[model samples]
Target: MWRQSHKPTKLFHRAQRCRPRALALLALFLVASTLLLCGIKGKPSSQYDPPKLKRSRTRTSTQFRPTVEYTNGTDLIWQIPESPKAVLFIAHGCNGRAANFWDRSPGCPYCVGFPEERLIVLHALDRRFAVLSISSSRKCWSLGKEKHVVKWITTWWIERNKLEKLPIMALGASSGGYFVSALAAEMRYKSIVLMIAEGVFDTMGIPEGYPPTLFVHMPKDQRRMRLIERNMEALRRKGVRVKEVRCLEFPLSPNFLSDRILGLNQTMAVKLIRMFSEKGFLDENGYMRKDGRATRWKQALRERGFPLEKYELLNHIQEELNLAYGYHEMTSLQTDDIFDWFESYMN
Candidate 1:
């Protein structure tokens, strides 16, 4: 009886020792399962994605496509919103084409519109404006002859659409700005927005009925600043209503690109920011130190295993960097202000 009792006591002691090991294994498995469920097995929890915001559907969200046509050896890319109240003529900078303000559509596959340009177009479309763009025949706009061509195209489009009574407006960037300023002298526009280009009123007198003009510029270029100032003074002297927007340099945050551009994940954004910092392209405050076009940042990114095939990502980064430097480039930062100025003249 004593031996049997001693055996049971030893078995009880053995079971107690094994119980802790079983519990430890169970606890470890639970932890691993939790990590797997949270998708933190390979990636850190800090990099976990947040909930995505639902984008409100717009009338033209899925159906907003541009049409491409040719007239007199010039390519015309255009879109008209339902019940358009006005017609907007968009002119691109030097070396840019008519498709610069539109995305690649089934109708126009060759279109390579930048985000800045696309945003501007969308803003105009949302306001029920018929947008039209014409390619320059040469490398830059031929103001002498193109103005007549533009007038003919405008008349044809207006008569075809039966929108002869709608207000006409024009927005141009860089060399295109010069073109529009010259075109305005010959034609009557309800309003004109010139970006990074001074008017040529010095050579030609500002008409008594000169349209209201809005000048968008970067003050960093002292020579261009003086020219724009001269243009503003000339317009004011003619009693033509004028407004100006001075685009200033802005710093980049971790989510700067991700916020403005789509398909760019926060992880990649953070990585790019860090890489820029390490490569001496970004200063301590995340502001670009040098012109992005001149830097070897693209090559450096390729070396760091960034996906160079993603051209959209590359383009957005390049544009944002240049914008941060406040260099002479196209911008959509003041799209609302631009449209507001245009509408104020409509009445």
Candidate 2:
């Protein structure tokens, strides 16, 4: 009977050892199953594919598929069609966003119409060029602050889109023009287009080994145009290929009359007259009568020795009061021509 009891005790000890091992094995199995399930669930669906290269149907009607991304606290909106041959980077002017380039809402400050945007973007895509529009971090571009960041983002984008071997061109307007000009000094670009660029380049000095550049401006903006021409001349002197296109003609809208005159309240009008008189564009008598006629202003500009023949004078009085109005008018008229010029160098 004692031997029998010993046998039962031995069996009990063996069972105890096996039970712990069994529990451990069961726990491990459960963990493995859980991990396997997670792997299956987390896998990306085959139906959801990544962006693919698409062939453009026609130059005039190529469709653009735009995507927006945020990198290093900057907004980069880009359109990459299939197998792009090159890339174009566009910098927006002061208080402008990437969306402003494509957005055509009435509220958009510098809205280019949808038809125009389509024509430009699609034409680029058809020619196998990816387009990127970058917005500034602040109200205006700060090249010192944003240049490195922009460079990194642009490089990353080129790699991500498999456009490693492609050439890059830049286009900018106003403050954006200033940004690109500064950037060109640091980075290599195939070409650059500047529209109504600021006079910042004079202070900075034109950098050596800069790329070919095209400057587009309104003739009536004598101060800014003179600055651009001066820079262009300097670039030419350096043996850099540079060209300037003066948008001498513009069509004015009927509502432009209201925008020039009635848009300003009596208080604003009085202030404008005072400013104009101080600029010597109006005599004290003309200022007193609030004479905003083109004829009178032309006489003032002529007396100042401004080359009137170089400018296409619209039949309106308000052109003398606002330089921006004149600039915008030219932009509308010359959008297609600008694109054509850009295309000319793409080859």
Candidate 3:
């Protein structure tokens, strides 16, 4: 029979058809994915899924920063906060250490507390459970080598561990002003607050359009206080945040102004800090009621022993405001609100 060679059987025809390659490939992929999941089950959470980073609660917010590292072998009087996130690196004035910046001391009139590290922490609590302490550097500044150190500390810390990338704020009163200014000028810091501080910057030559800075120099007494006003205005024009607090006691108060040459105790320092930093702590007219009686700020200074007449904080309210990590008898630093402003400032 001319049946062209026997027709192939149905089974033979089906065998010649293409294999289920698509289905087999899909099955292989599914198996591989399952293996990956099973393998990851033995790994740490961080390996399988990264840890969530802590971001600023607000465009401005505060939180504790743990796991910090100090670079340049610099010795800091570091104090972890009761709560944390905000850090204050205080540069001491001439003949000063971080300890000398308190307000009240005995035998000295107008003093309420001995400069203590704890009070700084206390002041920062209102802003957030923050930490305020100084690092011991010898008249160092951000103008030159000091600037390198500032960058090193920040970079070193970031590379060293996993802490929220909260930037540090620089502050200094009197002699410590130089460091603060240099830092503001050189480093990529969050911001800076200069209290009764400013002078010829020994090392800073930063051009315009640098980090946002705040200069709060003595309005009445610091030498060059009035002169720097023009520069301060210029900085504001450059978009730098600046506020010159006119000490009601200044000019009226002596130049070496000691609102509190030294401190009385932490208790008293706490009270004055509240009075000065908090808005409502002082009346709308800038007077705080005493026992429901009206009291002038200078008079109150006298009552508290911060006699505006003889307390000398700076020779040229301007020169001593430098912050070159020098020694300090004490610091008249603004309270935690300085940090609160930082939140809004950075945001």
Runs of candidate 3 with Cα error greater than 4 angstroms are 1-73, 99-113, 116-118, 129-142, 154-161, 199-209, 250-337
**Tens-place lDDT digits, model 1, residues 210-327:** 8999988877777998998888888999999887776656555444565555456544565566678899887765567887788789999779654567555577677767776777
Candidate 2 total steric clashes: 2
TM-score of each: 0.79, 0.57, 0.48
lDDT of 1 at 234: 85
Q: Which 10 residues in a row give candidate 3 its minimum summed lDDT?
A: 248-257
> For residues 13-115, what per-residue lDDT tens digits would candidate 2 score against the true structure?
5545565663454344333322221111113433222121111211345544567777898877778877777898887767667865453333343433232
RMSD of each: 17.1, 30.8, 30.0
Clashes of each: 0, 2, 51
Candidate 2 lDDT score at position 74: 81
Ranking by lDDT: 1, 2, 3
Whichever of 1 and 3 has more lDDT, that candidate is 1
- Candidate No. with top TM-score: 1
Residue 240 lDDT, candidate 2, scale 0-100: 77
Per-residue lDDT tens digits of candidate 3, residues 31-142? 3322221111125433442111111111123222322223475533333444446555666655454443323223223322232222343455445433333444665333
